[model samples]
Target: MSDAYLVRYVGGPLDGRVDTLPGLPDEPRETVTHVHLHGGPKIVHHYDLHYALEYGCEYRLREAEERDLAQD
Candidate 1:
């Protein structure tokens, strides 16, 4: 399995400007795994980038090629 990295830009919708939270700052989403910046399923931050790796999501990355195509 391998790892991946992602940079996320924070800055949710404006408050009251929409129809959700009246005059409050936009709410932050959850933080991602291994990514402490931006927002994922944990902690909190703003206008930051996050790095995430998903091995299961990329089975092709771990698959064999050419002669091993049948195994794939």
Candidate 2:
């Protein structure tokens, strides 16, 4: 099994939440999409990967104009 590392989400709705994701350290810095559901239409938050730490990775919220869906 692959090692699970902490993924810290900075800014946006999921800010300050650290999730355990399984992947290699050499993975590309891609957009991280998080779907939020709260009795309404599902909202997707896109974060841009920024830095890689010793035990985790940092992802910042993408600009509003670059997002696929807009927040209500």
Candidate 3:
């Protein structure tokens, strides 16, 4: 197995972004990323490993919780 592999992000702010992650798909995985909207505060997004395909792994974006939303 390779030391690192490619993963595809689905949905959310990181949608369509490809990243090189270290480790094998032997078990489930989760990842977090940061995004800064134009003229807005930085936001964090969470994703969970969903599928392992021939080309790469797919991570589905998790729904935003109350805390994930920006407080007015």
lDDT (0 to 1) per candidate: 0.27, 0.81, 0.70
Q: What number of clashing residue pairs does each candidate have, in the order they appear?
A: 10, 0, 0
lDDT tens digits by residue: candidate 3, 1-72: 656778888888778999886765576465655565677777766677777876668888866663266332
Tens-place lDDT digits, model 2, residues 1-72: 767898888998989998886765577467778889999899878899888877888899988876745544
| Ten-residue region with minimum lDDT total, candidate 1 | 55-64
Candidate 1 regions with alpha-carbon error over 4 angstroms: 12-72
lDDT of 2 at 47: 91
Tell me how far the alpha carbon of residue 18 in candidate 1 is from the true structure, in angstroms, after superposition. 22
Q: For each candidate in turn, give its C-alpha RMSD to the true structure in angstroms.
A: 18.7, 4.3, 4.6
Number of the candidate with higher lDDT, 1 or 3: 3
Order of all candidates by lDDT, from best down to worst? 2, 3, 1
What does candidate 1's lDDT look like per residue over 1-72, in tens digits? Answer: 323322233243211221222232233333322224454565422222132233111111111243254335
Quality of model 3 by C-alpha lDDT:
0.70
Highest lDDT: which candidate? 2
Residue pairs clashing in model 2 are none
Give lDDT: candidate 3, residue 38. Answer: 71
Per-prediction TM-score: 0.16, 0.65, 0.55
